[model samples]
Target: MDDMKKLLEEIEKLKKEIEELKGEKEKKEFMESEKIIEVIDKIEEIVKKGFSVIEGAVIGSLEGIKRSLQEKENGR
Candidate 1:
């Protein structure tokens, strides 16, 4: 969970970097723009993986809780 949180934080940092680069883009060269695009792609990949992991974790926890509740109801 903590790792997933860190990955999300990294995505935020990447977004900020892109924004900063855009502000200075007119003064920069074409290669810099290409680099920004590459970073954006990489960030997209990381965000996808991070969200999937977090989603799986949350679903699994919910299932566990549901099972526990069912078992208690059965016991009663």
Candidate 2:
């Protein structure tokens, strides 16, 4: 039964090694997910700011055109 005992020990060792690898893989996946979330948040912020700037520019352009037309009508 000595051969059977040795085989069992080898199997246990392999199981432990497999468990460690699984843990490492999970940790790596978690880190990658966190990085993706961070990048998405940054993109959202940039899009929001970009839209605000565009809206402001559009409003300013409209006001300038209105003023120009008013001045022309008044013969100024």
lDDT of each: 0.95, 0.99
Tell me how candidate 1 scores on lDDT: 0.95
Give the clashing pairs for model 1: none
Lowest-lDDT window of 10 residues in candidate 1?
23-32
* Candidate 1 Cα outliers beyond 4 Å, as residue runs: 1-28
Best by lDDT: 2
Candidate 2 residue lDDT tens string, 34-70? 9999999999999999999999999999999999999
Model 2 residue runs over 4 Å out of place are 73-76
Give a tens-digit lDDT track for model 1, residues 1-76.
9999999999999999999988778657677888999999999999999999999999999999999999999999
TM-score of each: 0.58, 0.82
